[model samples]
Target: MSERRVLGGNQHALPASIFADDMSYVALGHLHLAQKVAKKEHVRYSGSPIPLSMSERNYPHQILAVEFDGSNIKAIEEIIIPRCVDMLKVPTKPASLDEVLATLKALPDDELPREQQPFLEVHVLLDKPQALLREKVLQALEGKSVRLAKITPHYSQREQQDSLQHRRLSEVSPQQVFALSWNKKFDGEPTEAIAEAFETLLTQVEEQE
Candidate 1:
């Protein structure tokens, strides 16, 4: 019987002391998938009981119940729990906003947990006029028990590149381009003076390195 060691499922092997005669079961965690390690029968990993992200939507949520016989491992049982939250990734064009809202409203409330339904991440693919999809979704879900975890807006680099192509080579300074690009990608006012200062500091540090 080894000392009970809880570890991530992605890790390999149990310590020698964990398998000692007087030791008990080793309960592991993480790796979002429940599994037994080796033939020892006592080492196990209990995955997340709920799907915390869109990538884990297919995984069943469960809890592990282990019974120990004194200092020896007896039986390990997996208990499946009903999912309290549902994670959905819906891709929509700008024109489909109304339809998307309708679909979300039509989702069965019975399937959702009473406490709070899982967070939903909406991926918006804008093919038409620009609109604040994030603000719209947040407003729609407001007061509702369900939480809108995030709204991701997808943009095409080709469209931006094509727009940039119209600018004359002489008109597009590297510093200006950098400032424009950085300001667009990140939320904040970026000034040429600040950019110059950062560049000076970066060059000084690089020289030291």
Candidate 2:
């Protein structure tokens, strides 16, 4: 029988042998956190040169500079790149989209990453985003190295509503109601066989107790 394994890190996963090679250099993608994967000296991931999400706000974005000699690793260097995306989560009030665009446009050309330089991704978080503001942001970043990955609005409000609803439902103490709500709100109903299997497993656990 063949066995399967799962690898987890930085949102992108691949087979164990993906990097097992004699190549002069291995450049990995899908990870915002850039680092060398093996002690082989040439295998490295050039993390996103710019901040793509709020989780990476503190991480210093950089690129990898490597020298290869025909299937052999020579030297590896990391070049610090400029910030192209401004991932800010602020209230949508008062801060119009034009204001945000102006702020970005006003940034010195040196501050903005060049289009031919490298790949860049940016995410802007807002409490409540306006349609006009979003349009402006898109227009400003068009053709630039910067691209908006997400624009979340009213995040706190949605979380609060869900929390309140869950708490209220839990207080009723109705098993059937809870089951229905859980299936409806979170996970949908399982197939008849799957549900029966789970119930049997639960009964066995209770009997053991």
Candidate 3:
């Protein structure tokens, strides 16, 4: 027997009864990461031909070949697919726009065809929107051989801290609120400098009011 959507956010479980000791092999799909299932060597996910997301850029995609001899598994070998295009996340985390541009400018010159050029995703950490965000990125890519797929901006400081004033009043420190709010929005924690800067901003705002 076989299954699909075992990965890609699908939570359905693969039944063990299909992988009885008598079974020789099972081919699976819907998971971008190739992996074995049910601790059975014969049951496996073929994964996608290419990485579907930036998170999977590190590993090479693969195809599995299973040889069978008289309904018994003979061999399982992996064939690595050549990357025709690349998916890269610059800095791997939130960083200054200049730092991100610097990284982009430092990339090895891409002389390949447009389709072969790497797909770059830039991460920019800012306090507010930059009106010329796309223009700035394009300027940085001048004379470069790459496709700028996206510029994901993360706000380091909360744009509306006052909204949390009444909700989390019990929180003792503004830094604590900043950390919590960041986690709530991005599902991740802020760095020490980011938290401290937010605390300083909160203090300044209080003084003004």
Candidate 4:
């Protein structure tokens, strides 16, 4: 039982008493992190045995072994599962593309089996788009003991706003597109009357289609 959200909806925890007092054990699922319900020793979640996503790389995976003595639990043991492959996030903190490339180049050069290679995630801080970014990153990662996972690029708030200004025509709403044209031609926002007329015409056009 968990007092956690489900599918974005709030959910109240099930009463631990829902399990009969004499029941020796209760196993549950649907949660990614292993936990004991209401701190009850007999209730448990085993969680996932392997990393389901890079975000879950740090979750402790385990299998619970239970011993029963005439229908009552005599012992419960947690057996930790060993990690099969490593997950590496380069430049753990977001950094410029150059710094990310440098870190990738410095990764270990061991010639391990393909299945043994660690999974690599590149974290980049972007101020502006750079040409040949994928190619440059790939070249830097050559011979590294890792399998390239994906590149994650993020921008500062100011830069993100500036980038949004150049979004494609289809990505902008009709009103926003009209506002852009109006400003370019008149260097000011459209007057209320003009904006109302435009919206009326836009509605009529939409109805026709």
Candidate 5:
């Protein structure tokens, strides 16, 4: 009665409390990543047979076969499942539409079965919807064999900086706006030296005016 947990085939439904020190082995699902839960080797998730998310695509899907010696777990073996349909991400993270389109168009054709062909997930960093957006993506994939499963448009940190740049100077504080501009240029926070430099420039401009 130590390990009251059983193979949870569904995702995210397995409660951690079900795993106890006395349990010989546990098999769980719902979480897409193969991981040891609660720091117990006997407790684990087999993950999905195929990656359900873009993040999980790098790791191989596995099946766990657990052996028990008396009341203790002997060993846990992993059997890798061959991937049929691949899940891929364009531009990896949220990127400009142009970069995403270029990645999609550059994808080499894979002569697999239509059902086994890779599924692409495009992540675009866009502040607002563009005209004929889906059409543009479809056009890019015109000759590609990959299936366009999802097009996730995200408002990224770069987009925030761009928005600040477009805003009126009177609408935002000088320090805040300048920091945003600095982040946009450097891809990081403004340093103390940069802040002093900005302040010095502001003082000079004010005196000149």
Candidate 6:
């Protein structure tokens, strides 16, 4: 099998058909969801023990318990893992500064053990930079039983197009150049995390000079 269409999606790797004749059970990894491949109970992916990224927040993380009798899989059971800490995106979806602030402030304030603290990602729908917006969110999260992860600022398409203006190439910094190029190619500003990652890499390169 060339392009193996598994339970998740089509994988370009080894086709499940190649192991069809093999009597041994195949346990695979890499895919994030625990599932069987090619409708075969023997071929499975246990998936990650926890959510690897924000996109996988809703994924049910579990361990697959396979009972083997001789060379065949007798039974396959999914063992659900208890979530020690929750991952929360304030207001669920991107919201205005006021709405995000109110939701952040209204979060569970009870002081729990550090290990039990939920991971929080603050999502703010911004058309333009709000003065001290991140600072205000941090202030609101103060004394709360949550670990602040990152502040995600989603810019509107109108705001992105508004930034398209001619500027002297030499007058702009590397970050500005990157932003301009990104906006021109993709028509949107890079996320805060992406910008920070580029900055970090830039700093490292400069240090190596």
Total backbone collisions for each predicted model:
7, 1, 0, 0, 3, 0
Best-fitting candidate, measured by lDDT?
4
Give the alpha carbon lDDT tens digit for every residue of 47-132 in model 4.
66776656555556788898999989999999989998998777767789888988888887899999999888787888877778
The TM-scores of all predictions, comma-separated, are 0.48, 0.37, 0.66, 0.66, 0.59, 0.66
Clashes of 6: 0
- The lDDT values for all models are 0.58, 0.51, 0.71, 0.74, 0.71, 0.72
Tens digit per residue, CA lDDT, model 1, 31-89: 45566665566666676787655545545679988877777557777899887656655
TM-score, candidate 2, is 0.37
Inter-residue clash pairs, candidate 4: none
Which digits, one per residue and each the tens of the lDDT, describe model 5 over residues 61-80?
Answer: 88888878888888788999
Candidate 2's C-alpha runs over 4 A off are 1-13, 38-40, 84-209
Q: Candidate 6, residue 80: CA error in Å?
A: 1.5
Name the better of 1 and 6 by TM-score: 6
Q: Write the per-residue lDDT of candidate 6 for residues 51-140, one digit (tens) a residue.
A: 765545555699988888888778888998988788877766678888998888888779899998888878788889888877899998
Predicted structure 1: lDDT: 0.58
lDDT of 2 by residue, 162-203 (tens): 544657664633323434554667665444344335544443
Selected candidate, larger TM-score, 5 vs 6: 6
